[model samples]
Target: MDKPKRRNTETDPWSGLKMYTAARIALGRTGTSVPLKESFAFKMAHAHARDAVYSSLNLEVLLQGLHAFNLPVHVLHSMASDRMEYLQRPDLGRMLNQASSEQLKEEGSSSTEIAFVLADGLSATAVNEHAIPLLQLLVPALRQAGFTLAPLTVAEQARVAIADEIGELLHAKLSIIMIGERPGLSSPDSLGVYFTYAPKPGLTDEARNCISNIRPEGLPYSLAAEKILYLIQEAMRKKLTGVKLKDGIGLLQG
Candidate 1:
């Protein structure tokens, strides 16, 4: 006689009965192979576990991603041989060196209507990525509106206050500075834009207008550029900015 073929189902009637009974009791219905992993509860539990891991890492990775833009603008440190010296000396970063200042004085036009400065304030990566695209958008827009942009400058070891210095140096009617903001573990490579009408030393934050969070995850580059232009126009008209201007104004507000 041919050997009996083994069945996929339980051969023992009692065992099969017990499994069936347990399935009905535990799951309200059942078949073989519990199917626990395929259930909705298992999927939801797995998703939560993945999310927990991502939340722990936070925004630093996202900020670093901004550096991938690989912009073509000149970096001040590359042009200056003493980049490390300036970084070590905060005072040096606050003002252009004698050579650079003199160069600007000689080559810079006195009738400059607006000045654009890019600075690696805290995160060079942020300025390298966001600032270039923003300027690409802004420079053309301003030009179309019949405004002249002064020779652009990229400052090394720059602080936000340097905008005032550049504005004074160029005699620009308005100065716009794109700088890297203080990196948070949550937001490492964020960029900030500061616009000042007639910037000068000792000018408070209240005298400047700021558009911050210019990264892929924060403010998109195109939108940030437009807002900066709008703010510059308003600042020129009102002769003031910052807290004095109406808050909650701009394309982003909508």
Candidate 2:
């Protein structure tokens, strides 16, 4: 007996393109707006995106994941007391809380070659979901490269600039902060990585290098690690980062 043919429910000409990207594209329409199911899907996606932004990190869980690597982990807080303040006052999120500063000081003022920081940026969900897995691959690779690692620092209510203060406090030659990126309509769990060389408080955006959109569907962990490791080696060699330093991943691959 012959089997019946399967019919394609997505009739839009551009529907095939959906396979290429996560972007909301070629959504089938009814009159002016999308079909009821598609419209409802859009609403659900928006809710997920919003939830990712407002969510708080479970620091204990993150600590447990980091501890599995057998590395020293320290918890720190930004000056922002809560998520509300963190959203409203970005500058506060860029500085460590007084107690956190004291804690870092007590950990000792000895300089290290490099420090790794993890932070809950605009999307705590992203950090909770993706940061540790990337670190699982990155930390060992960094060690194999002969980099002396400092105690890993986990910062709550943090901004990318917070790494500068943490790096300065630890006297690290370089600091890499893995943080949650702002959620998009489709990418609620995308993570970001930022690096600063000889980080300090007054440094501008031009002083750091960023690799963004890291997730399973975005930049895969292994490739992101390779790019980051390449950048760090170059940053150390040139004693620079940010605009002046080029991401040599392509060149290295070539």
Candidate 3:
């Protein structure tokens, strides 16, 4: 038996072409067999797994970021080192403790047209990433538009309902609370803002206007700021917000 002839460029012009074709087929470019190792689905799954680990909120980092803003901070419940404690005790998260409430009452402004508050609702990463920038953009815009701003507050262990509590604490005609929205795989650092006109206890979500997903991939800061200011103006003009304000006034009109 004779050995198969070795093909080379010197021997045959088609040798390189044959080698290339064989390599391509071996790499599954011909689609005879699925390339499980290099498949897009496999790469995507690996990417998602990495993101799940890295995108998780670091509350300590988040707190440091908020502190950099030089805003007043208050905790609603006893500080717990455990994340589960903070998540499980939502009742503790809803209202400021007596000491915090007193301090808020003593230190916070009593009268203002609008008050701004930040809360780590679910994704503390949201506050660190989106909340501060959004608030910074909004506050100056509101002031430029002749809206008065109360002292800003950072509420720990706070929920959405705590906006009403902070509103009542500051006695503000309108209150805007920026919170970390529940994280999804697509948006781990999403920020949401809820604005309540004439905010007080017993108010529901229906009693406030909300702007969600304020991260870079969502609404831009300048646009979000403009929309918030416009909504505040509209709420003042109509004396209502949330569900009561018909015609969807001040909502991102073309």
Please name the candidate that would achieve the greatest lDDT relative to the true structure.
2
Scored by Cα lDDT, where does model 1 land?
0.65
> Model 2 clash pairs?
none
Highest TM-score among the candidates is held by which one? 2
Residue 49 displacement in candidate 3 (angstroms): 10
lDDT of predicted model 3:
0.70
Q: For candidate 1, which ten residues in a row score worst on lDDT?
A: 52-61
User: Considering lDDT, where higher is better, how would the candidates rank from best to worst?
Assistant: 2, 3, 1
**TM-score, every prediction:** 0.64, 0.93, 0.70
Expressed as tens digits, the lDDT of each residue in 148-211 for candidate 1 is 7776777766777777877777788888888887665445567898888887767878788788
Stretches > 4 Å off in candidate 2: 1-11
User: Number of backbone collisions per candidate, in order?
Assistant: 0, 0, 0
> Residue pairs in steric clash, candidate 3?
none
Which of 1 and 2 is the better model by TM-score?
2
Candidate 2 lDDT at 83 equals 90
Per-model RMSD to reference: 15.3, 5.1, 10.6
